[model samples]
Target: MASGGSKSVASILLALNLVLYLVITVIASWAVNHGVDRSRETASRLPIPARIFPIYFPIGNNMATGFFIIFSLIAGVVGATTSLTGLHNLSQWNAPNLNAAAVSSFTTWALTVLAMGFACKEIELGWTDSNLRTLEIFTIIVTATQMLCTGVIHVGVSEAPSITY
Candidate 1:
């Protein structure tokens, strides 16, 4: 068993990681939205900035710009909560599913970059703006986080003695 100090360190790290995750996620979302805005601005077209996005797994057109719209809305709530209370987390009702949200978040980030990069003319596919690869890697990492947490939760609960009908 780990010592109390080590456990405390781990918990702190976990909390920090969650905060960083949400921060980076919101940043990525905004970056994509900015890309959208730039594209529209350059083309002189008007598109409503998405303010809400789906937290569910997005696929095909389901993973469309609509998802970003939903995300924008949710991010606003998350940001407000964090700004007001310095608490960075989901409710217990939603905590176990965070990894899934992360999946959608990173995928949205990647696709937004892709649309703005290869599909649009907002960013150069330079060394740093290698958004596709970066998003891909992030997606993989987030997916792994989901799987690991699922496994840990399964084993943890399996070892418990409680029986709930």
Candidate 2:
């Protein structure tokens, strides 16, 4: 509802989110393309141990894992725009009615996911000893910011596409 009536804000937010997500994805992809990336090499060397979803979610969830989740995060946001939940408040779906449930639920769910994904930090080691954990948290924050920015930018706008971001 926020930026739906105005395209400028929505586009700007989307572009920004995409850029941030791309930075992380590109770095991870490069690491996969080369032997320089540690996760890829480890996964390839010991494929058996990488089957667990959570453990394997980040590095190779699909985009190549160490960064694959970033792509999924993108997909999740983009998908929400087109999902049934998003359409409930759109002019295309409800010519005039604006049920609060859809908006509330969608907003709540989106924010919750973004928060969880953004602030995720499963490991608790000495701050100085957990470089990768720190990096993961950093990525989560970047991804979360992108998602949150994209999702909330148009919350009060009218008739604009409800982006999952």
Candidate 3:
């Protein structure tokens, strides 16, 4: 594909990913807050094993829910950051900028995939709220979008004419 084509594709994907990541961040933050509050209320009444674990989520898919939420939060933040970097790179439209954006986008995609794995686990465990289910769907979608963004950036970088010192 032409550099212009790649840039447009990356821009669109980055925008989409940014919005999805922000949504994930907000929902995950709410879930974390809810989980903490519930855990605090039941802390004293909880059993030894439950009390021992620092991150205990009383709702959703039990243990897997906690992992999923944490990872989703991480991925959301990283993905947002990656999107910002990608936007900057798009504005510049150079090999170095594209490379940097590609690296960050790849990292964010990996984190998103990790979160998606936990999402799958949470799904398998069952019993999740509507917000969590929404989060899972977004995470899965972002994983693919992020990968596409990274791939497009890399292709753009590679296709650019080499600079001689």
Among all candidates shown, the one with the greatest lDDT: 3
RMSD of each: 10.2, 8.7, 1.3
Tell me the spans in candidate 3 whose CA falls farther than 4 Å from its real position: none
Q: List the residue pairs that clash in candidate 3.
A: none
Q: Write the per-residue lDDT of candidate 1 for residues 109-148, one digit (tens) a residue.
A: 3433333333222113223234433443443343344334
**Which residues of candidate 2, in runs, are more than 4 Å off?**
1-6, 33-119, 122-138, 153-165
Alpha-carbon TM-score of each model against the true structure: 0.39, 0.39, 0.94
lDDT: worst 10-residue window of model 3 = 156-165
lDDT tens digits by residue: candidate 3, 1-165: 498898898899999999999999999999899988888776667788878788778777477888999999999998998898789888888777888888899899899999999999988887788889999999999998888888888888887655557
Per-residue error (Å), model 2, residue 135: 5.0
Native-referenced Cα lDDT, model 1: 0.36
Candidate 2 C-alpha lDDT tens digits along 1-165: 334543344344445544544454454344334423454455565556453323343232232333334443443444334233333433343323233423433453464354344334333212322333433554565555545543543343445334353
In model 1, which regions exceed 4 Å deviation? 1-20, 44-128, 163-165
The lDDT, on a scale of 0 to 1, for candidate 2 is 0.41
Q: Which ten-residue region of model 1 has the weakest summed lDDT?
A: 84-93
TM-score of structure candidate 2: 0.39
- Top-scoring candidate (TM-score): 3
